[model samples]
Target: MPETLPAPCAPEDARRVACIGAGVIGGGWAAHFLARGYDVTAWDPAPDAEEKLRRLVAAAWPALEQIGLAEGAAPNRLTVAGTLAEAVADADFVQESAPEKLELKRSLLAELTAATRPGVVIASSTSGYPMTDMQTAAGDAARLVVGHPFNPPYLIPLVEVVGGERTDRAAVTWASRFYEVAGKSVLTMDRELPGFIANRLQEALWREALHMVANGEASVADIDASITEGPGLRWAFMGPCLTFALAGGEGGMAHMLDHFGPSLKSPWTRLEAPELDRALRDAMVEGCAEAAGDRSYADLVAARDQGVIDVLRATGRLGGTTR
Candidate 1:
């Protein structure tokens, strides 16, 4: 694990936070911070982005309150800034949730780095891009790090802290504490890897799901059920490795590994990654539509959010500090 540092500011002192690119992820970041009692300044160039971000934050509060994550934080704590520099000028932490394009991110980070104070950590919300690219454009490269949060960050607790080659350990440490205090589960990356850990793991399962549908081995609905009803249940409490250990009975992982070793070479195992084709992509969309039945996207998102709240509350992880 990377060294953990103290929070950049005490909970009471964590007031000024800046968010650049108030899109989906940026708006989520703003919600998390504002809901945690921080004064959030959000900036975006899109026409009506400020109003959209405010609406998004407002919509998120009820769900967050339902999950017992929001305390007494008020909506007025959120402020929209006209310029990127103005948003970050007094911020203790600067979060860039801009587009995934490398060039755009580089430009934003450069501006944010120059605007913010010396010790303010600049975290990027890019899903797959490496920090090295952003750091190259940052005025103080040491303060720029990847702080990718899962979707709907105000609801999900996981946040991946990735450090680039030039990143300072102290910056990563401070960032971990900052996120933890904001009600997030922080995972530090040992080294910079594209997609980090969780996304890569998700992609692994997604690849198999797509392949199964493409091969006609299972419909999209069946595959969804296979997970939502099967491994998903076990995964709620124990991860795959631990679940396998229990599967081995008295033998544990070594025993299970020995038994499954032969299957490793089988074609059923996705040992190699497959390229996504147009046909498979279309099949996936169709399968998902079939699985949807009468449920709309909005309904599905609400249901999924409720499920997450239930699981977290049952596990006593909701609004609970791990550290």
Candidate 2:
């Protein structure tokens, strides 16, 4: 174990951040921190990781700037570190985006715990692992928590904040406030759970999607289009619960539940999720290709970002509050 360093200054007064992995998610984390005016130092063992990190920042900055998320954001606030310790040294906040393997995360968190100040909160970007599992390897586990972000995090601003059994409530609250101030939707979980909220919800939809394609009910493109053209539009503003509430007229959730409750026990629905077999995977690839037509993944992602920006602006809900 390493000696404990001094406490970090207040968040507003802190200028430095450390990102432990420079992969896709780590790069996004670095971009968000740098865009918010914090100098970032990141580390990854992969060859050319530094260059990749720089490119990710370059690519994400323009989209963020277009939406005023990067207004007054300064350059030269990002750096790549040669080692894990080098990354977290003197950092105010450490954001880890390493691989999902438990042993790998344990080793990394141990190193990070040794390297950073005790007062510096170490936030993991792990989407599936429970916070308790991630913090177990840390010497000071209380400072570790889940700060999972959605992909293309610089543009889509939903972060699920989860605390381990030993995690400090103050840490969770401060983490929520920190992300909110940086223009993010922070959903704090009441308890630690695998996949958190968004990923679980996403997995549920994905399971059904896979089932539909596997059973020849729909093509991958058809499934995506079904949501993109239908529920996706409604979900852009309010979630499924709220949307159904409105669907129930003045009776709200009670009326909706009464009308749809019977479906809960229905055997017609494909309640059991299908496995992602090779055939389904190939079909999905082909379906996506068909959906793409001439548009590249880059083009599709940009379009989605623009649509989200438009919806947020139209609803007067962009960057206001996280409540």
Compared with the true structure, all predictions reach lDDT values of 0.77, 0.76
Model 2: per-residue Cα lDDT over 135-216, one tens digit each: 7777877677789998877778899998888777767776777778767789988898778998999987898888889999
Error of 2 at 201 (Å): 1.0
Clashing pairs in 1: 157-185
The true-versus-predicted C-alpha distance at residue 155 of model 2, in Å, is 1.3
As a TM-score, model 1 comes out at 0.79
Tens digit of per-residue lDDT, candidate 1, span 1-323 = 12223335653456688999999999999988887878899999999998899899889889867766455677788889888888888888888898889999888887877777666788999998999867777667777789998898887888999888778887887788788888789998879998899898998888888888999989999988888656786666456664554465545445565576556566874655344445654454455445545766555546555765677566566667462
Best by lDDT: 1
TM-score of model 2 (CA atoms) = 0.80
Q: Please give me the total number of clashing residue pairs in predicted model 1.
A: 1
Q: In TM-score terms, which candidate is top? A: 2
